[model samples]
Target: MTISTEQVQTAGRLWQEHRQAPFPDSLRRAEFGGTDVWVLDLYTAGCVLAWLDNDGILDAENGRILQSCIEDLARVIPEVNDPAGAQYCQQLHQLAVLISKNLASTK
Candidate 1:
């Protein structure tokens, strides 16, 4: 998939925003939306941003994988007890939505 300049710019901006804070360390287990889920820490969110920035491109395969990760994170956002972690996850979710939209545009 060919990534647009806008997508690259958006990814960069998101990466910068994600890096502004230290990743949260607490892990909590809870059920959300009637499903058991593990709340993701800030590290996971950082990894997502890093993955996108590292590649500078989101192909079909990798985009799917990353999107799934973001979706999973979104599902458990309510479960995250740490305010920072929830914010990070919310940022990650936004990044994921951007990637998904870009991928769809390419298709």
Candidate 2:
């Protein structure tokens, strides 16, 4: 149940990439689409991972929060019509799942 060094490294990389991405203005709009929500969800999970990276720990509460974000994003992915957006969601989903698994093991 120990968190692996590789998991921590991967989380760090994902957090860096997430931080570098521009915030989507569509996220503020009331009429936002699946892609917009996807971006927002990714940001949420990235923030959780960032906390883990900074503190070198993932509590059960944050782990639960991360799991919720991942599940919510998964629901939105199928609603995304754009191929590029779908692919992006898929990639993020994979990373999020990995992080979630590692965090779960910590608990």
Candidate 3:
């Protein structure tokens, strides 16, 4: 499924607000889609969120990698369609948008 343009634009706005918040020094090694990766924290939440920004599999300019991040999060996050999972969805959406905007600026 494709992410709507609204999702990207809304996420872009949300990203601007939290762009400066530091990711804590605390981190751990984890696996994502069979690849070994370092993540911000042990919890799946942190790991999934970090995956959006760091995974090299995505091509930022084309937006496919950002799309992949969103798809991956949907699979990894439990009950993503449920009310409690809304926050995870929101974070994923924002990160995807941030990635998109950053890539666009470089072009």
Q: How far is candidate 3 from the true structure (C-alpha RMSD, Å)?
A: 9.0
Instruction: Give the clashing residue pairs of candidate 3, or none.
Output: none
Q: Would you list the rank order by TM-score, best first?
A: 2, 1, 3
- For model 1, where is the 10-residue window of minimal lDDT? 35-44
TM-score for candidate 3, residues paired by index: 0.36
Which of the two candidates, 1 or 2, achieves a greater lDDT against the reference?
A: 2
Candidates in order, TM-scores: namely: 0.63, 0.65, 0.36
lDDT of 2 by residue, 1-107 (tens): 56667767777787667556554443333123433574456566654655566444566676666676678668766766666555555656777776766653343
Measured on C-alpha atoms, candidate 3 has an lDDT of: 0.41
Instruction: Give the lDDT of residue 33 in candidate 1.
Output: 62
Inter-residue clash pairs, candidate 1? none
lDDT against true structure, model 2: 0.61
Between candidates 1 and 3, which one is better according to TM-score? 1
lDDT of each: 0.60, 0.61, 0.41
Q: Which candidate ranks first by TM-score, i.e. highest?
A: 2
